[model samples]
Structures are given as C-alpha cells and as structure tokens.
Target: MISMQIRRLTMLLFVFVFAGCASQKSIVADKRLEEKIDQNFSDAAAQYKGMMRRLPADRFPKTYYAQTDKFQTGASSDWCSGFYPGTLLYLYEQTKDQSLLLESERILKVLEKEKNNKTTHDLGFMMYCSFGNAERIQPKPAFKDILLTSARSLASRFNPKVGCIKSWDKVKSYHGGEWSYPVIIDNMMNLELLFYASKVTGDSSFRNMAISHARKTAQNHVRPDYSSYHVVNYDPETGAVKSRETHQGFSDNSTWSRGEAWGIYGFTMVYRESGEKSFLKTAEGMADFFLAHLPKDTIPDWDFNVNQSGYTPQWKYDPSKFAEIPKDASAAAVAASALIELSQYTNKKQSKKYLKAAEDILWALSSPKYKAATGENGNFILKHSTGSVPAYSEIDVPLTYADYYFVEAMKRYKELKK
Candidate 1:
C-alpha cells in the first residue's frame, strides 16, 4: 500500500511538471512575437540624425523616391510642410537631442507664416503636427498663439451650407464640371487642431465647428462596410452632397488604403478628444474593416479595390496590364498608431487584439523589408510607402508622414508597455 501511494505521488508530479513546461514555452513564444519597441525607437532616432545631416538645413523633406534615389522637398504652403519639423520634434522627444530641438524651432519660423493662410484646408497638417507637438513637449506661448491662429484660418474654410470644411480649393466634379467646395476623408484629421484651439481659448465656436464637421463626416463619408470615399462634393449653396466619388482610389466604390487609414486615425482621434461614444463606435467599425482587408503581411496595397492580378484604371477602362502594385507603408504606419490609441479605449479582449495587430505592423515596419538601411532610402527611416498612386505621384517611396506615424506608434507602444 505504501509503494502504490508513492507511485501515485510521482505521476501527479510528472503531470504538473509537463504543464509548467508547456506554459513556459507559450510565454517564450509570445515574447518572441512582441515587437521590440525600444529598439525600433533607437533605430529611428539614429536614422533621423542621418536624415538631418543629408537634408539642407533650409529645406524640408517630403518624400524619398527609391527609383530616382532622390529626396523631394515641399514648399512652406504645401500640405506636407509640417512633417519635417514634426518629425524632428518627435525625434527630439525620444532622444532629447539639442540640435534636433533647435532645428525644429528654426523650421517653425518658416511655417509660422501659414497661421493666417486660409486658402488651404491643410493647416492642421501644416501647423498642428509641428507646433502642436512642440507645445506639448515645451509650453511655449508663441506656439499656442500660432495654433490658435491656424485653427481660425482652418475654420474660415468651413461653409455653413456644406456642413463640412472645404478640403480642396478646386476639384473637377464627377460630371466633368467644377466643384467650388469639396470635402475629403482626409479632412477629418484637421479637426483636432480646432478642438485644441477651443480648449485653450475656452471658445465654444471652434469646438462647435469641429463637432459639426465630425457629425457630418460620420454621416456621409463612411460607407456601409466602413470603407470611406475619398472625396464628397457638397452643394456649397444648398448643403447637399453633390457627388460622392474618389479622386485617388481605383474607383468611386473602391477603398483607397491611405484614405481608409486617414478615416481610422481621424475618427479615433476625434473620439479621444471629444469622448463621443458614437465616434468611438464609428472608429471601431472602420478598424474592423481595415483589419479584415489587410494583406497577409499586414501591409496593404495602395488601393484595396483594385484588381490584384493586373493594373487598370476604372475610369479610363483600359485593358488590364500585368504588374505588381506597390504597398503603402504610410497606411500601415497610420493604422498602427491608430490601433494603439484605439486599444486604450476598448474592452480587454479587443484591446489585446488591437495592440497585437499594431505590434505586428510595427515589427514589419522595423524589419529590413520596410526599414531602410543606414544612409540609404535617401536617409529616410522607412521605405515602400505609396502616395497618390492614381495621381502617378510618389509611388513606392519613403514618405515623411510614414516616418512620423511610425515613430509616434513606437512611442505609444513604449508608453503602453510601461
């Protein structure tokens, strides 16, 4: 009887040991899957230092075209003008590098003039990304004033009749006419600047305008499947949607990858700033759509609605031409950052899923496939980002915004890990 009892004890111990080993193995596997966020941050800072050295101190980088091995510069009034200084500020935040901070301040001087420029709908991208970040890092009264002025300038573009801010100064209408006022999905991102302006000034007008724009966009821009249209034309006099079409996607019904990312990021940000449950729900739905459509590697094609087997313009109706379409790393970066934010506002189960998805994308971006070699990719940190493929512009390049959001996502990841 004693020998039998000893045998039973030994079998129980063996079972417990086996289970513990299995659990340990699972933890190891999970850790391997986790992204090395801090390592990526270090890598990004080093690459940005190189980029700063390569770029002319007076100019701002917009994109790096791999085919030409050339870096493109944008004018001060260009929508992308803020990304350079914005990136510098992001890098400065991570590294606390004095030179980057000084360069960012100097770049701000060049962009400061746009505070009152009302012609473009991109003041948020032009000013907020740069000065907003600066204001967050270091409380500067001048930066606050510039942001307030920029918000008012952006507000000036909002037409009461259209219930949305004008995205483009001019756009060819779907009927081959002209649209005096048009709103794009991309416009959703500019609302944060207005929201911030309202908070700083205790002005309800800016907040009201932002809420109205968000409501209108939430109603019109998102489709049934959560895919967003690129452009929505509104009758400037009547406040009616004149036409819903796409200028940058494969077709009116097709999903442009970057446009989808913009919608996801924009709505997620709106929910963060406003605490509106509706906005959160809208963002969640869009996130689901985006996750479902992502390619096997988490990177997405420039336009999800295009035929993968061949390239063809839906409008011109040309014969299918066989070629591989480029992926948009910018879209992936934007979605990754958006997902990180979204995870914070979701249930535990969803939070885990969203964070895991973000980790996967960030890992892919940091990998050799997307992360450019030192001193290569025109000194940019990322590669293979597509910008306006339909417009035949900046295809298969490293975009400034891609690097900006990638850095932002990594920062957010670090914050979450802590």
Candidate 2:
C-alpha cells in the first residue's frame, strides 16, 4: 500500500512538469514569430529604398528654401515647412547620411526666426518637426532654448475660453461675419506641442490647455458615427459649440478623407501624451469609422460621398472640367502610420487589423497609379494629394508628409520585432 501511494505521487509530478515545459515552448514560438514578421517588414523597406536612389546633394543647395505656399490663403499653407526636414530625418535613418540631418538643422534655424509669428495656423506642423523631434533626438542647449521659445509662442495662441487653438484667422473677409474663430481638425495634431511643452517646462497650464482642447474637440467635432467635421466653431467667450462645417471636403457636410485621418492620428497622439482613456476611446471610434468606410485596396476618395460620375466642383464659378482628381494617398499614408501606432498602443489583435489596413494602403501607393517616377528633386511616390481648392497647387503631386509617414510606418513595423 505504501509503494502504490508513492507511485501515484510520482505520476502527478511528472504530468505537471510536462505541462510547464509545453507552455514555455509555446511562448518561445510566439516570440520567434513576432521577430520574423519584423524582419520581413524591414527587408521590404530596404527593397523599396533600392528603387529610389540617394538624393543628390549638389542638386538643391543646403540653403535652398521653397516658397511660402499656403494650403488655404487665410490659414498657413506651408505644411511642408517643417515636414521638409522631417523627410530628411527619415532619409538619415535609412541611409545614415549626415548631410540629411545637417539640412534638417538648417531648416530649424530658419523656423527659429519665425517662432514668434502666429499668423500661420500650422505652428504644430511647422514646429513639431523642427523643434519637438529635433530636441528629443539631438538635445543641444541651443535647440532646447529655441524649442522653449517656440512652445511659449504656440501656447499664447490658446484661448482659455474656447479650450482650443484658434485658426483660420478670418471671418470671410473681403466681407465680414462674427469673429468666429474656427478650430480645424488638423489642430489636434499640434496638441503634442503643448503636452511636450508642459513636461519640459513644468507648466501645468499648458498641460491643462491640451486636455481641454482635446475634450472640446471630442465633444464638438466628432459626428454620430465618429466621423468629424473639418471645421468647428466655438464661442470664444463661453466655449460653447456654435457650428460644424467641412472645410476641405466637397461640401459642408461631406466626409473628407484627409481630415478624418487627422482626427484619428491626432486623437491617438492625444491619448499617448495624456494617458486619458477618453482620448483613446475616441481615437478608436474614429479609426473604426475610417476603416469601415474605406473601400477595398484601403485608399479612400477625397470625400466618401463624391461619386466619380456625379462629382461637382466646390465653388459655383469653378469650371467642372477636371472632375476626375486622383485620391489623396498622402493622407492615406499618415492615417496608416497612426493606425499602426494605435494598434500597438492598444493590443495585438486590434493592432493587427490596423497593420493590415496600413499594409494594403502602402501596397496601393507602390503601384504606378498613385506613385510618381524619380526626378532630380522629386523622388516620391503617391501623388494627387489636394491641399486646397482655391490655390489649386500641388493638387496632383507627391507631398512631403506622404513620404514622412511612409518612412515612419516602415520604422514602426521594424521596431515591432525588437
């Protein structure tokens, strides 16, 4: 009886040990799979790079500056002002070229001069690349001082009453209306500047403003299905919501694809900086709406409602000759990158859905339909991105932001394995 009891104990121990070994093996296999996927993504990025050679240094001098082009006249049009250097940073990462970083530094110097200016609504786009990322990566004392100065300048634009950044600096003016300060969906992206400023400067006011702005946007800008208006008006004194309108889309109510991308990416960034559950939830909701609405191949038309056959011009006097404008792949690229980040910040299963969607968009961008051939200064794929209807510029060419986000997505995918 004693021997039989001992034998039963031995068998139970053996079973427990075997199960433990199996669990350990499973975990190892899962890790290996992740590593393999990351390696594959990196390999793909490298392959893509081979197709586009290193940019020639002699073609455009280091100090060569592009014109102060506006996306819209009243608001700032220079989206590429900061993005130009950002593209160089991307190139620096890929090529380990010091020249690219030097060029980026030069752009920062020029922006330093314009730090005090608030006429442009695109301070975030202009400064984030020049100062925010630059300070983080390089961290020189000079850069820090310039960055701090720029942050303060940006914070001054924040109106406490509206709980958001005021932009579009005009009321319709060749005529006039109430001095309604329009808050654009793109402003959400610039909130990071406030958050970073607060952290570095130990200013609670800046952080508070950031949170308030995000909350206000969430409440007013988002629609029933989480689609958002491109432009929203708020009472400057009471912070009351006044109206919601679409600035970039086909109509006041139409769903602009790039504007939707801005909302998704911007809200996600807000959640990252604030750790606010509400921001994350709102971002996911917006992302879900976007993913649900995008047609197969993952790229969306400029406005979801605009049919190819029945598309009309935005203005009454505008000719209807060029109705067949290509889709905005630049916006698609940025949205894809943000979705991937959202996926990782959230979880694996959720992340995979976004990752897959981003991959589909990238695959589409790679095709000839969207991509442009290499030129002396134009070595980008993914063209036909619309900036503004009135200006009618860069309407069908590769944008700086498109290239930046494409590189960014590729970088994140590579990091996933490590």
Candidate 3:
C-alpha cells in the first residue's frame, strides 16, 4: 500500500509539471517570431534611408507603382500628406536618428498651413498624424497649438443638420444623381483628433461632436455582419440617411477592405478614449468579420465581398475576363495595429487571441512575399497594397500609409513584449 501511494503521488506531479509547461509555452515568445520582428525593423530603416535619398527634398511621397519604382508626390492638401512625416517620426522613435527628426520637422513646417484650411475633412490625417506623433516623442507648445487649431478646423465641417462630418465638399455621383451630404466610413478615423483636443483643452464640444458622430456611424455605416459601407449619404435638411453606396469598392453592396479596416481602428480608438463597452463590442464584432474572411496568408483582398469565382483585375472595366486580385497590405497593417491595442483592453482569453492574430499578420508581412527588400519596391517597406479597386487608383502598389501602420504595429508589438 505504501508503494502504491508513492507511485500515485509521482504520477500527479508529472501531470502538473506537463500542464504548467504547456501554459507557459502558449504565452512565451517564439524564437522565429522575435527574429522576424527584428528583421522587419532593420529592413524598414534601410528602406526609409533609401527613400530619403531618392525623394525630392520639397515633396512628400504618396505611393510607388509599376516596374520603374517611381515615387509619386502629393500636395500638402492631400489626405496622405501627413503619413510621410508620421512615418519618419516612427522610424526616429525606434532609431533615435536626428536626420529623420530634421526631415520630419521640415515637412511639418510645410503642413502647418492646413491647421486652418477648411476645404477638406482630412485634418486628422494631415495634422494629427504628424503633430500628434511629434508631441508624443518631443513635446512642444507649438505642436499643441497646431493640433488645437486643426481640431477647430475639422469641427467646422460638422453640420448639426446631418449629425456627421461631411467627407466630400462635392460629390459627382456615378448613378447620375447628386448626393446632398456624404459621410464615409473613413471619417471614423478623424475622431481621434477631436477626442485628443477635448482632453487637452477641457472643451466638451469636441468630445460631444466625436461621440455624436460615432453613434451616428454605429447606427448607419455598419451592417448586420459588421461590414461597413463606403459612403452613406444623408439629407442636409432632416439628417436622414439618403442612400448607401461605395465609390471605391467593387460595388455598392460590397465590403471595401480599407473601409472595414478604418471601422475597426476607429471603434477600437473610440473604446480607448471613452472606455465604453458598446464601442468595444462593436470593434470586436467588426474584427471578427474581418478575420473570418481573411485569405490563408492572413492579408485581405481589396474587397471582401467580391466574388472570386468569376473575378479579374480587369473585371472592373472589362466585365468579361477573370483576373487575380491583389492583396491590401495597408489594410492588414492597420488591422494588426488596432488588434494589438484592442488586446490590451480585453480579458485574458480575448487578449491572447487578438495578439496571436496580429502576430500572424506581422509575420506574413515580414516574409519576402510581402516585405520589400532594401532598395526594392521603390524603397517602400511592404508591397501590393490596393488603394481603390473600383476607382482604378493605386492598385497593387506600395503606399505610404502601409509603411506608417506597419511601423506603428511593430512599435506596439515591441512595447507589449517589454
């Protein structure tokens, strides 16, 4: 009996030890994952250095396409203008390189005029991305003033009649009709700037506007499956939704990948700012819809609702041929960054799942299949990001925003590891 009891105790000890090992294994960083993250940052630094050498000192890079590896420049008013400096700040944060900081400051000086410009709804992209990151890294009173001014400029676009910020000043509808007031899902991202402004200035107006816009978007822009419409037109008189359509997606009914990414990122940000459970639930739902439809490699095609059975790259114009569609690395990067932040705010089970999904995407993007080698892909970090498939714009190219979010995601991942 004594021998039997001793044997039973030994068996129990073995089981407990094995279980503990398994649990620890699940949380520990894999050697391969660590190597991939390090390599990605190293490659990114090299690529940005090459970009700095190639790009004209006066212009900001927008995108790169085709076999020639040519860099495209955009105006200061362009929605993507902030990404150039924002990306530089991200790199500077990692490397502490003074040259990168100087370059970003030069660009920021040029972008300062947009703080008062009211022609567009992209002040967040233009001001916050640049100035916000600047303040985070090196605080300056001037950056805060610029950010506050930008928030006021953005607030001017908010029409109480529509209950949402107007996206386009003018709309030329493809359906041969005029849209009175248009709100795109992408506008959800701009609310971050307002939330920040409210916090710093002790102004409830900015916060109220952000909450109202979010609630309105949550009511109309999101579908039952958590997919988002690209644009929702509202009546200027009654604040009623007039029509739902997609200008940059496969069709009016299809789900645009970048738009969906914007929803996920925006809602996740909303939850962060407000600590609202509803916002968290909304973000999780959209994240689930996005993850459920991802390709095997974890990156998404330009439009998730597109029928792959009889689709082609030329189908947008030809309508008769089958062509392979391109993946949107920009969307993947944005989603990955959002998921990393979302993981931090959730319970343990969900935190693990979200973090794992983000890690998978980062690993996939780090692979040669998507990560551009140094001096390649027009000196961009990642390749094959689709901007707008239906509009035939920036299709299958390297975009500046892709690099920005990729760097941001890697930064967030590193912080979590620490």
Instruction: Give TM-scores for every candidate, taking all chains together and pairing residue i with residue i.
Output: 0.91, 0.78, 0.93
Model 1 misplacement above 4 A:
1-35, 308-322
Instruction: For candidate 1, write residues 189-238 as lDDT tens digits.
Output: 89999999999999988988888898899899899889888888888999
**Superposition error at 335 for model 1 (Å):** 0.4
Worst 10 residues of 1 by lDDT: 313-322
* Model 3, span 16-95: residue lDDT tens: 99999987886664556776777777778778878888877667898897577567988888899899899999988887
**Local error of candidate 1 at 302, Å?**
0.6
Q: Lowest summed-lDDT stretch of 10 residues in model 3?
A: 313-322
What tens-digit string does per-residue lDDT give for candidate 2 at 1-418? 9999999999999999999998898568546544543443344334324322442322211111124322221112354566656656655665665656677675566556656766665667777765666776778877767666667777877898888888777745111364488888888877787777788889888889878989988998888789877778778889887776655666556678888898899899989988999888888888888889888767776666664445443444243645674467777887877887888777667777877676667666655566554431234434556565434445555566776676676666556545
> What lDDT would candidate 3 get against the real structure?
0.87
RMSD (Cα, Å) for all candidates, in order, is 3.5, 7.5, 2.5
- In model 2, how large is the Cα lDDT of residue 228? 79
lDDT of each: 0.85, 0.67, 0.87
In candidate 2, how many clashes are counted? 2
